[model samples]
Structures are given as C-alpha cells and as structure tokens.
Target: MHASVKMQFDAIANDYDRQRKQLIPCFDEFYGMAVSLVECEPSSKVLDLGSGTGLFAGLVMQKYPDIHLTLMDLSDSMLDGARARFSRTDRVQYIVGDYSEYAFSGQYDAVISSLSIHHLTHPDKQRLFHTVYRLLRSGGIFVNADQVQGHTPAADAYYRKQWLEAIHRSGLTQEAIDSSIERRKLDINATLSDQIGWLEAAGFTDVDCMYKYLDFAVFYGKKA
Candidate 1:
C-alpha cells in the first residue's frame, strides 16, 4: 500500500466502523454473503488481508468461535482499533504490515478480505491472487468482498451515479461524505470477470462471484 493510502485509513480508523453501514447501501447482504461462502471447520486457521479494524474477521469469528485468525493491515492506527475489538481474546493475532509485501508463514484453511484489495493496481491484484493460492492448504477457500469496475463506460457511469445517490440518502454529514470520496481516489478496481479469470489462472477451482450490487461484490474460489 502507498504511504498516502495508509495515512488516509489511519486518519479514519476511529470512525470507520460507524460509517461503514452508511457508506455501503447493501452492507448486510454483502458481508453476510461473504461469510456464508466461507466453509471451514470450527478450529480452522484463517488469515485476513487488509483487515482494517477487523470488521470482516469479527464476523467470521462469530460464525466459527474456535477459529484462529491472523489479521494484517498497513496502518497501525487501524490495527489499534482491531486490538481494542479483540482485546480479551487470544485466538486473534494482529500484524501491522502491507499485505502485498508481507511474508506469510504457515498454511491457512481460509483467507478473507473485505473492501480493501481494490487499492492495489490490477497487476498487483493478480500477483496477490497467486500468493493467496500458494498460502492456502489444499481445499481451502479464499473469499473477497470488495468493489469491482463495470464492464462498459455507460455501466461505470451508472454505478457511480447510483453510489452517489445512495450515499446522499444515507444521512451522513457532508464532511464525512467528502472524506469518503477523497479516500476513493486511491481505488484501482478490476472488472468482476477479470478478477474471476485471475483467480482461475492462479489455480483455483469453482471461481465465481456469489453476489453483486452495482460495484460491490463478493467473489471466491476454492483451492483444488
């Protein structure tokens, strides 16, 4: 992650959890679908990339109480929020580092990320997919709930228009909305089809997008 991007997230770390539902119109369904697609045993070891504030990992932990998780992110301030969230628990471990360059050790039964991977350039996203494939144990799954680009220019316009309308109606303060918009400048989203292709090329099976609402999507593949 770029230093500016990390700084942006660090600045918003305190307000991120409260603002997430408002920023994302389909917040419940988007995250619920991603959690549903994660199939693992109760004691499965899981890894989360770009795990800002541990929101997604918290959801996964709720579903599998015994699952051990390693959460990685680029900003210490964001990780501080995660530390607070899981303060009394030993099952969760927090690592402050860039997921793209981090040297992951040991195999994982499941890997998940939400609303973070889009910050990487398209080529980096493809390379990260390959790294995730290599890090997973056989039959393990990788699930990503993030944003995607529309296939056509008109479709892209519609996506942006709908997002703007939804956020305006979400009752957030104008200042908050402006900050969100500024942060979005770092996004480098890929098309859903292209992401699925990358996952398949990285040696995943049954690669498919499980859900989508405009630019928001939940996609995953199983290592085979």
Candidate 2:
C-alpha cells in the first residue's frame, strides 16, 4: 500500500470516531457479539488484526486490564493512530505490515479482526483464516466482525446498493468511495455461511455465526 493511501485513514483518524458515530450501534453489536463468545480475563492474550484507529482494541484493553494485545496493520498511519489511542499502555505491542503475508509471531489466546477482512480477495481471506488457525493454540478461538456477501442474487444487489448509499449518506466523498471500492478490487464478497465453511474446512472446529444484521456478521471458530 502506498504511504498516501494509508494517510487517508490517518487524516480521518481523529474525527473517525465522531464521524462514524452513526455506525456505533452496529459496532456495539459487533463487540457484544464477539465478547459473548470469547470471554476475556487476566490471562487472555489477544491479536487484533487490521486494527484501524484502534477503536475495538481500546475497548478490549480497557475491559481487560491484564490482557496482552498485539495490534497489526499494513498502514503506518493507522498504526500511528492506534499508538496514540492506547498511549501509556505497555500491554500493547504494535506491528506495521500486511498481516496476510507477514509472519504472525506467538500463540494468541484469541484472535479477532474487525471490518477489514472484506477488503481482501476471497483467496486472501482463506489464507488469512488458515494463518489465524495456525497461530491459535489448541482450543483457542478466532472471531471476525466482517461484511458478508449475500447469497441470493436479489439480496446481494440489495445489500450492495444499501451499503453504498449508507456510506454516501454518512459523509464519505464520492471519489473516496469509488477509489476504495476500485483500489482494493473487491469484486465479489462471499456469503457469511461460505466464510464459516472455509473456517471449518481449515480444520477449525465448531465454527458458526455469532451475530448477523443484513450482510454484516461476526463468526467464530475454535482450534481443535
């Protein structure tokens, strides 16, 4: 990713929370759905993938004071925002790199990625799931808050148009929307059910959807 590309997120980082307040209900649902599955305690060591602006990470950090966290992202600018958000917290370790290719070090008690995996190509999402499965200790869990592709043709078209309009209404510029949709080459999104099947195919056990609202969902699976 180009430096400037990451800078786009950095520019919006400070206002990101305020501007995206409209989505708070959705994110709160995401967080609640995630935590219900993987309970955090003092011993939990969490890996937060594509942790933009560190919103979810901040919540986890605050809720579990003793929990250790590894925050990873491909964007330097986003990492900068994450660092500032959790200032004075030695419990967090930061890494700047593409998580899909970068080597994930250390076994995590739980691994979670929020709202970023949809940006990946289908094959990349599979590779990422396999990598996460590998990184987990036996019985450890993996959960993701992600956007799913609708299964039916009609539903897919409906959700696509709805999502685009939601972004437009929420104040994103037309150019940014077009550029982001194009730059990432997000041509097809897999249904939530299909994503869970991939996790099961990766040898993860007990994979299932934790929550769903339209095309947005949180899914979790446990390592055997």
Give Cα-based local distance difference scores for all models.
0.94, 0.76
Tens digit of per-residue lDDT, candidate 2, span 62-110: 6687888899887767777888888887888899877878976789988
Report the Cα lDDT for candidate 1.
0.94
For candidate 2, the clash count comes to 0
What's model 1's lDDT at 72? Answer: 93
Top lDDT: which candidate number? 1
- TM for every model, in the order presented, reads 0.98, 0.85
Model 1 lDDT per residue over 1-224, tens place: 48989999989999999999999999999999999999999999999999999999999998998999999999989989999998878999889888888888899999999999999999999999999999999999999999999999899899999999999999999999999999998999999999999999999999999999999999999999
| Candidate topping TM-score | 1
Clashes of each: 0, 0
